[model samples]
Target: MPSQRGSARRRQRGVLLAGIAILLLALVLAAVLASALTRGKKEESLEPLRWQGRGTTRNLREIVLGRCYGYLAERRAELGDKDCLKIWESLKDAFIHKNPCNATTEDYQPLMKLASHPIPCNKSLFWSKTNDLVHLYTKSSRRFLTLEDTFLGYMFDGISWCGDPSAPGINYESCPKWSECEGNPGSVFWKMASKMFAEAACGVVQVMLNGSIETGAFRSSSIFGSVEILNLNPDKVSEVQIWLMHDIGGPQSESCSGYSIKKLKNILEERNFKITCEDNYRPVQLLQCVHNPDHPDCSLCTNSTEAP
Candidate 1:
């Protein structure tokens, strides 16, 4: 009987040990799944790229007052009122305490009304995907004004903001990526702003397109193509100058005579606007040549004609 009891005890102990092992395995699996889920969420948050310190209202305010206020101060007299406080208030009112994904262009109408101004004739510059190069060139030369150079655009160019219905204010932690919704606040604002900027274009206007794109630089989905180009008034704007930017090295594909560009030209000409195209604008090429002097296309940098 004692031997029988010992064997039974051993069986019970083995079952307990097996149960514990199963529990531990389950825990490990759960942990691995949780970790994978967290990693996926993090990766998904990186969509619709934004600059640093751009997600929160507090950080955005600091940028507006500190960095952008200086830009506003330079033209305060012309700007009138110069109440950046009002601008901030209106901007936040458009998105805060609302659905992050449902924001529309109309949401920002109040801010636009407060910030709207007429851009000088022939000074308006439009670009498609060439954000970095266009901004760099425009900042260095006072010859043109891209949307960001404007008071409102300057204040919020690189910033990102969105709202939560459950939350009292902005959601700086995570917001629906811009591409996740057509009514994304950031994209809607820019599209509306681009429309206004294009509507304001007069005399000779310039468009800088990246020549490296094989599908063609002028995409109808782009802000320039979707909003700006359509809004341009043929009566006010006499000419559209296309600056096709290419890398310093030789694999240049799109040019003034490229099929895609010719389509763009035909569109402009149909609107009764004169079309002009330059292979590589001197200023932009010079910038590339400066950075990459040893490139084969550097010779063409100095030789290329400047935009008239």
Candidate 2:
């Protein structure tokens, strides 16, 4: 009887041990499932925000088409052969039904090819940190042409667009800012367009820089410094002319002899290109003086005889 009772107790202990082992296994499975769910939730939360800065601009298609027609109407002599509809389709296909942040220069090749045109030699003007002044100078003087003055740049200027893998394709709810991602649609388009503009440039190319920028006028990271300057064909481009202009009210932080300007000159020279640097180029300065006529620096001429 004693042996039988001992055997029975051993059997009960084995069953209890088995139950504990099963309970441990179940707990481990539950822990793993909970961890996986937590990870999934974390990933979902980290996805990029769908709505950025006013979403894609409204009437994107109409705006693009209108600009295309307007460009053809104005520059018929130069770009009369371009197919507007095809151009639009190429532009749309670039980012449609795709991730907005995945934009690449290759995606814009079709549009570039379709819209390609020759920039007149010695007429290319590149600007860095000088948007308003550069455009103003280009418009008022008509001596040079910037990218925005071209057909491709004009059509998409100030427009925002992106795509979704879902229905309707376009993300009309919002679009990423240029700073949000390197592959931003607008940023990619402009980088390619700038590159093309630089590659096609011949003779002397002009660059306008803002001298008042404390961070230095010729930033290597800027489109002009990074894209346009690097893409310029040394054989085709004879020289690079740098125009360092400062605001009329003063705060002149950089000059032709400054570190940034010298850096730009060195890069051009290294690439076997001649370079010329000018400070407060008179023509552009005169334009700046238009609004600040009372500013002392606006008096570019000391005597009546010096007035042009």
Q: Please provide TM-scores, in order, for all candidate models, with all chains considered together.
A: 0.77, 0.81
Backbone collisions counted per model: 0, 1
278, model 2: CA deviation in Å? Answer: 0.6
Task: Score residue 121 of candidate 2 by CA lDDT.
Answer: 94
Candidate 1 lDDT over 155-239, as tens digits, reads 8877788876544467776666656777778788888888888898899999999888888877877888778899999989989
Task: Point out where model 1 deviates above 4 Å.
Answer: 1-58, 301-308
Task: Note the Cα lDDT for every prediction shown.
Answer: 0.81, 0.89
Per-residue error at 10 for model 2, in Å? 55
Clash pairs, model 2 backbone: 55-174
Candidate 2 deviant stretches above 4 angstroms:
1-54, 305-308
